[model samples]
Target: MTPLDQKINTHFPGLVVRKDLVRTVKGNAIVPSYVLEYLLGQYCATSDEATIQTGIETVKEILRKHYVHRNEAGLVRSNIKEKGRYKVIDKISVALNEKADVYEAEFSNLGIKRVLVDSGTVKTH
Candidate 1:
């Protein structure tokens, strides 16, 4: 870590991600760069090289397990149905359904639509 890097890490721990490491963690996933950076912020925020490497593996594992791919939408849906609930990372768009008088969410990559969302979540997010 250089002097500037060390200074930044000192002042803003757990909020900084090394720029080069972004490419290292980003692998063919269609998600935006901010998403990857957010994950990196959680795990690779420190300037320690060893910790950053371990965090990179952790972020990759998280993407492999939780990220929803467009091609595997059916499988992911099946898994969610079978398991009752499952956590996934994907782009979501929420809108109020005028006809139903309810908030609904659409998962872009997961290919799921009309999933009801609570008003609180809809407002907060």
Candidate 2:
């Protein structure tokens, strides 16, 4: 384990992420760092220290590559098309309006809503 992992495991056994660290961080809009880190940990955690480190590096690289900046949505869209599949990290939530027959998708940063997404995606998730 990395020192950070070891420290976390020692102090907060069975807890996946250090959620408390999120609030202390200051920024314009804080979307819990623990959420991103926790996702990274899901892909990286291993009994083998070297593999874990490599996995951590790989996940961070993916985040750096795919996480969009304002002008980079086109790049991300191209990547998704090229890769045929991609995991997009966003504040995605489902909501029902007065017309309860339909489900709405809310993409936080992209500011998109009620786009036609395949029902299979929801079922799989």
Among these predictions, the greatest TM-score belongs to: 1
Tens-place lDDT digits, model 1, residues 12-113: 988997778788778666767888999999999997789989999999899888889899889999999999999999999999999999999999999889
CA lDDT of each candidate?
A: 0.89, 0.57
Worst 10 residues of 2 by lDDT: 18-27
Model 1 clash tally, residue pairs: 0
| Per-model TM-score versus the true fold | 0.94, 0.54
Candidate 2 local lDDT, 9-84, one digit each (tens): 6676434543332232213433447555665456544445576567556756665655555456666667778998
- Please state the error at residue 46 of candidate 1 in Å: 0.7
Error of 2 at 31 (Å): 6.8
